[model samples]
Each structure stands twice: as structure tokens, then as C-alpha cells.
Target: MSRQVSKKAIRDSKRTFGNQIIFWMFKILYIIYYMLV
Candidate 1:
């Protein structure tokens, strides 16, 4: 029971971390795009 819960928690955290990294990548790209315009 506890093992299943921990696995779910870890998966959720990994997903959130991936989303954050993608968000930052897009933000940086946006800034660069505008700078060149």
C-alpha cells in the first residue's frame, strides 16, 4: 500500500518537473524571438 503511494508521488513530481523545464524553455525562446524582432 505504502509503496504504491510513494510511486505515484514520485511520478507526479517527475511530471511537474518536466512541465517546469518545458515552460522555462519556451519562455527563453519567446524572449529571444522578440529581441531579434
Candidate 2:
């Protein structure tokens, strides 16, 4: 049970990091679009 919980936590942290990366990518794209306009 403890092992499973640790695995889940790791998976969750990775997912959270992925989401943050995606969010930053979108923000950067938006800034580029604004600059182009």
C-alpha cells in the first residue's frame, strides 16, 4: 500500500509538472502573437 501511494504521488507530481510546462508554452505563444500584432 505504501509503495502504491508513493507511485501515485510520483505520477501526480509528473502530471503537475507537465501541466505547468504546457501552461508556460501557451503563455509564451500568446506573447509572441501579441508582439506580432
Candidate 3:
């Protein structure tokens, strides 16, 4: 039971991290696009 909980926690953290990375990437791209235009 503990192992399953840990695994779920790890998966959740990894997903949030991936989302954060994608969010930042889009934010940077948007800033650059605005600057260019």
C-alpha cells in the first residue's frame, strides 16, 4: 500500500514538472513573439 502511494506521488510530481516546463516554454515564446512584433 505504501509503495503504491509513493508511486502515485512520483507520477504526480513528474506530471506537474512537465506541465511547468511546457508553461514556461510557451511564456518565453510569447514574450519573444511580442518583442518581434
Candidate 4:
């Protein structure tokens, strides 16, 4: 049971990390565009 819970938590964290990377990538692009403009 504990192993299952830990596995789920790891999966959730991996998803969260992916989302954060995508979010930051967009944010960086926006900043660059704003600076160029």
C-alpha cells in the first residue's frame, strides 16, 4: 500500500514538473517578445 502511494506521488510530481517547465518556457518567450517590442 505504501509503495503504491509513493508511486502515485512520484507520477504526480513528474507531471507537475512537466507543467512547470512548459509554463516557464512560455513565460520566457513572452518576456523576450515584450523586450523586442
**Candidates' lDDT values, in order?**
1.00, 1.00, 1.00, 1.00
Q: Which of the two candidates, 1 or 2, achieves a greater TM-score against the reference?
A: 1
* Tens digit per residue, CA lDDT, model 3, 1-37: 9999999999999999999999999999999999999
Candidate 1 residue 14 C-alpha distance from true site, Å = 0.4
> Candidates ranked by TM-score, best first?
4, 3, 1, 2
* C-alpha lDDT of residue 29 in model 3: 100
The number of residue pairs in model 2 that clash at the backbone is 0
After superposition of all CA atoms, the RMSD between model 1 and the true structure is: 0.7
lDDT of 2: 1.00
Tell me which of candidates 2 and 4 scores higher on TM-score. Answer: 4
Candidate 4 lDDT tens digits, 1-37: 9999999999999999999999999999999999999
Clashes of 4: 0
Please give the range of 10 consecutive residues that has the lowest summed lDDT in model 4.
1-10
Error of 3 at 17 (Å): 0.6
Please tell me which model should have the higher TM-score, number 2 or number 3.
Answer: 3
**Model 3 spans with C-alpha error above 4 angstroms:** none
Pairs with steric clashes in candidate 2: none
TM-score to native of every candidate shown:
0.88, 0.86, 0.91, 0.97
Select the stronger candidate by TM-score from 1 and 4: 4
**TM-score of model 2 (CA atoms):** 0.86
lDDT of 2 at 17: 100
